[model samples]
Target: MPKQAMENLTESMFYVLMALQRGDACGAEITAYAAQVSGGAVRLGPATLYTLLARFEKEGFLTDAGTVGCKRYYRLTAAGKAAYEGERARLQRCLDDAARAEITAPASLTKGDARDETARQGNRLPSGSLPVL
Candidate 1:
């Protein structure tokens, strides 16, 4: 099936919406929020940030909240909140699903036998991350 925009919010997309939960924010503020929330896991640089902001604004998930100089501000719409909350719920379910199962990492993965075990599989989960079966 052909994909639809925002069908599944990317980590960056989710963070953009989340960053506006408190109030309005500029591009820089949103990027900082994403980095803070993801423990530096998700970084949205200018190009990526503006691209997402444009897409979100186009999708009705966000609205322009005026601008200061060259910095444009945005506010999360009701739709945006719904999208963010939906992603949150979906992630919670993932954790719940993982919790109900057992994870066993093979020696190869545990010993970092490969170039980057963590990158290859979630078996040997990195710090602050979930494991793969």
Candidate 2:
């Protein structure tokens, strides 16, 4: 399969893509679910989320199915699904690599080793010294 362009996606865009992977959802529900899933780490404020959603919609990553009030419901297009899965896999590998680098580093390395590695990768360590996403 052709690889998807997931590396260009922002964190919120990535989370929103993953949120739509399982099923369709309106804006509010998507934000709520993403926030819950990320344990409030990935905040999808209205302006940011909807704006990205609009871009994703335009880019054929998501499709508008219907709306309730001002809220628009969306489902992932085939491309969107593929992108989401690809991005999820990429994120998983990043997390795995970070964890492995931290664990397997020499004993002389301290907590700063793990924290610095996480920072170098532009990722924050998840709560309890774990990766969140």
Candidate 3:
């Protein structure tokens, strides 16, 4: 099967989209905002930032808002918002799975405990229904 576009965004792509969420910004401004938001963990080089801007524009995730002097500004399009939301939900699911695993570690689970836990989560089977072995 063909790989999906934007199914998995790189850290740089995520931060870049996040930065644009604030408002339209030039390349330098976007890079600075990314660094600030990530607590200096994500610093986009000029080349990387430019390349991302170009790709995003081509993919309809961003639009060239305008230009001032030599600086070009960009704004997020609806496609960009969708991509950002999709990434956010994907990350949240990862966190939820990790937390669920931590709470249900094999070492802490016993035979009957699984049934009790399922009941607590409102997933109780019909009365007298056999649990899958």
Candidate 4:
């Protein structure tokens, strides 16, 4: 819930935040949607997922919109959505720059995986070497 905690968010936290970016959702629904959107690569367990949700709610990044049955629904607050958008944009640039490099490269390099994709390319610095604007 603290600023430092928010800044140090994990990938699962990011996925949950991204899932709630578009609309409100209950806990189970949020998890389901996140898994679907991520092509089943990221699955959020109940404890870890809800803890992050609670922290985000406390941080003012999310709004608790009450419950349906046993499910607690949440909507991203304006701040939460903005953070998600910022992360999304940053990730987009990473993808775009990597693609451009691959296209213009003299030879093929490692494909996929952010670290591998952005690893130093023959003395060329990584795109994310500088702070994202």
User: Which has the better TM-score: candidate 1, or candidate 3?
Assistant: 3
Stretches of candidate 1 above 4 Å error? 1-3, 103-133
Clashes of each: 0, 0, 0, 0
Flag the better candidate by lDDT, 1 or 3: 3
Using TM-score as the yardstick, the better of models 1 and 2 is 1
Best by TM-score: 3
Q: In candidate 4, what are the lDDT values of residues 20-64, reduced to their tens digit?
A: 876888888888888999899889999988899988888999998
lDDT of 1 by residue, 1-133 (tens): 9867677888888888889998999988989989998899999999999999888888898999998999889999999999899888988999887765436545555556653664687556567975544
Each candidate structure's TM-score, on Cα atoms with residue i matched to residue i, is 0.72, 0.69, 0.78, 0.69
Model 1: worst 10 consecutive residues (lDDT sum): 101-110
**Candidate 4 ranges with C-alpha deviation above 4 Å:** 1-5, 104-133
Each candidate: what lDDT? 0.84, 0.84, 0.90, 0.80
**Which portions of model 2 show Cα errors greater than 4 Å?**
1-6, 106-133
Poorest stretch of ten by lDDT in candidate 4: 107-116
Question: Cα RMSDs of all predictions?
Answer: 9.2, 10.6, 9.7, 9.1
- The total number of steric clashes, by the backbone 3 Å criterion, in model 3 comes to 0
Candidate 4 C-alpha error for residue 86, in Å: 0.2
